[model samples]
Target chain A: MEEKCTNVCQNHLTAVGDALYVIGGKWKLRIIIALKDGHNRFNDLQRTITGISAKVLSTELKDLEMNGFVKRTVHTGTPVIVEYELTGYSDTLHEVLSALGNWGTMHREKIRAER
Target chain B: MEEKCTNVCQNHLTAVGDALYVIGGKWKLRIIIALKDGHNRFNDLQRTITGISAKVLSTELKDLEMNGFVKRTVHTGTPVIVEYELTGYSDTLHEVLSALGNWGTMHREKIRAER
Candidate 1:
């Protein structure tokens, strides 16, 4: 029984740590949601997800793209257009996003109620 | 349609942000899992969740206690004992933890396959 419990807890700890590594940053989730909201242009994404500076946004975008959650394309034209979109792989995280969002919403209400 | 999406995405962003703000630290989730693993004392928690320094573990415990996710107790005897346990309220986050754990497991498999 003790061995079983230890194994289970160890798995949970490792799994949770892995999840945090992928989606744990301040701007990653917000940036993903903004793209889902149809913000494709660099400037548009910056505007939609407020308070994210250009340097930070660029770094995060690169990380997300590398992680396979985001797709970035450059259009060759008189003015080069760069767009960002969520890849289908990112949809796999729907459950995670929903879980976090739901808990956060409930927690906010609880905090406000106590206040 | 655009306005509606904006509102919905805004809510998701806010909710995700709130959730992350509470449980998003490097050690908080790991610490919570350690407590759930029945490692109630400080040294036990530090040992179970390896790599956490005494200072960081101390601070994270204080944050978790302040956020109402953990209960710290003291018992005076020949040698005073200190113990930590999850609060009933912390159970509310079972869904969040499960979602993250499941997703993380899947993600690990995916990465391994890609490699």
Candidate 2:
């Protein structure tokens, strides 16, 4: 019974691990962060976010939409524009990312000091 | 000159994006959260973490160590114990994960309410 319980627990952890694999990607966080400014289009996002390749950006956007962190709507007008917006799942990330941003600020300062 | 400036800026953003790739991963945040409890070992982490496979756990731990978020030490006294601890890089994650954990709690509550 104890062994069985351990196996079940391990299974649960693996599921969580799988979930994190989706959420814990490189551009996912930034794409969501950019969306926090409200709805943004593909070109705008590419322009605003410095280093994202068109391929990677497209991939991350699709992943974020699938994960429920973002919603993409195609506007039929004006060259069939597509825009992305944050979902409720993303509202939760705002605070978390803000905290991370603060950490990055401090981290960069520390690195500068070390140099 | 404008194109050159754009290239340099893009390079900076790419470097930052690369940094995020290392920081953002399935077990990286969880491992940091677990280590916040202070020193933990391979099996202990496997136990506390619910669902990580040994192969994945080993890989994540090695990556975190490489990224400076964790430090691994080997103890020679008894059975050659190995332990992992948070590094300065991880100290920053404490606040970020705390924010994330808080988000998870509220998120779960909302999910339950919907059900």
Candidate 3:
């Protein structure tokens, strides 16, 4: 029981860390930004966010779902389709990304001047 | 001359990418947050941000200076003193950090409940 308790505590810490790691992964932020235009099919996201490979998109989509940042819905039909949407948990990241983008635009001139 | 221009353009792109990489290093965000309290000496930064190694701090400080996020002033005296402060370019990141912090606190309870 003591060992079990210690394992549980350590697992919780690792889980939180892993959650951050998943969110912080390369392409994940871009993916979220891509999906912000409402529900998107897999191909839509892949096309919108330049420079992301297909394999990376698939992997990051699965990780985002696992971490509850996105919801994956499958439409059962002849071809079968999957769509992704921002979960409520992901709304805050929009503000974060907006700030990043704003900073990038505002600083580009000064940054170039510095160089 | 054409090759020189290509070299210049590609070098510029690579330089921008590398600057982002440096600012996004693991300890850099935490160090920036720590220094928000006011100007601080090297030891102050090292002490305030947990889990950062001395080597990592030194490396990050130098990177911050190179990227212009921080200004380093050296006070030459009996023992040379170094101080790090946020540059004007870095002021915008304070808004970014504040948003991140606010989101973290607001979501901590819900994130815990989700697990």
Candidate 4:
């Protein structure tokens, strides 16, 4: 019989690869998190998520939009406004965020203890 | 009272940033997974992880080694062989891997369904 671990390992690699393909790089996750945290408009997002340039944020947002993680909406009022919103990613993003946070906490503790 | 969501959101951004800091970028996670998947030797790793050049792999391995994720062991025998082994990161990595894998699986399905 084929070992169960081989299957699990392959799954892990494939999943990680897919996750990385969509959400890797510096700004993508930050942009998602910032938008989730209520900073929606371009200027607000630019201000809240520090150190990101307008050009890079624009590029990353377009990429995320293409990947179905984000959708940009425009409002016509006295002044036209554009806001970035999340696609229905709660089921996927919530767990991934929590687990990643836990991993980060443990990693910091481990490194601190080692040092 | 201060908003609960603000704290949670901050935690998420911090956690994701930290985790990404430790395990982000293209090659680091791939290298770690390959090593864990039983490809231990230098040549084996180079071959198992396709499309990675010897120089880039060497650089990534050394980076991993410095970050306390990988340890290189030298066996002195007829032929001196070196193998890479993991550091004690099971508590952190196991959950992260599983979560990332699940996210990947869902993400693929979602994108496919959307199309």
lDDT tens digits by residue: candidate 3, A3-115: 12234333333333333344554567667766665427876677665567899999999988987889998899979978789898888676556555555545665667778
- Choose the strongest candidate by DockQ: 1
DockQ, all models:
0.61, 0.26, 0.10, 0.49
Query: Which residue pairs show collisions in model 3?
Result: none
Positional deviation of residue A49's Cα in model 2 after best superposition, in angstroms: 2.8
Q: Which pairs in model 4 have colliding backbones?
A: none
lDDT of all predictions, in order shown?
Answer: 0.88, 0.67, 0.63, 0.78
Candidate 4 Cα lDDT to native: 0.78
Per-residue lDDT over B49-76 for candidate 2, one digit per residue giving the tens place of the 0 to 100 score: 7667999999999999986788899999
Ranking by lDDT: 1, 4, 2, 3
Compose the digit string of candidate 4's lDDT tens values, residues A1-115: 2123356566777778898888888778878888888778888788766678999999999998987779899999969989899988543677777777788877777778888
Model number with the top lDDT: 1
Flag the better candidate by lDDT, 2 or 3: 2
Candidate 2: which stretches are off by over 4 Å? A1-22, A66-68, A87-89, B1-19
Worst 10 residues of 2 chain A by lDDT: A1-10
DockQ of 4: 0.49
Model 4, docking class: medium
Give the top-scoring candidate (TM-score).
Answer: 1
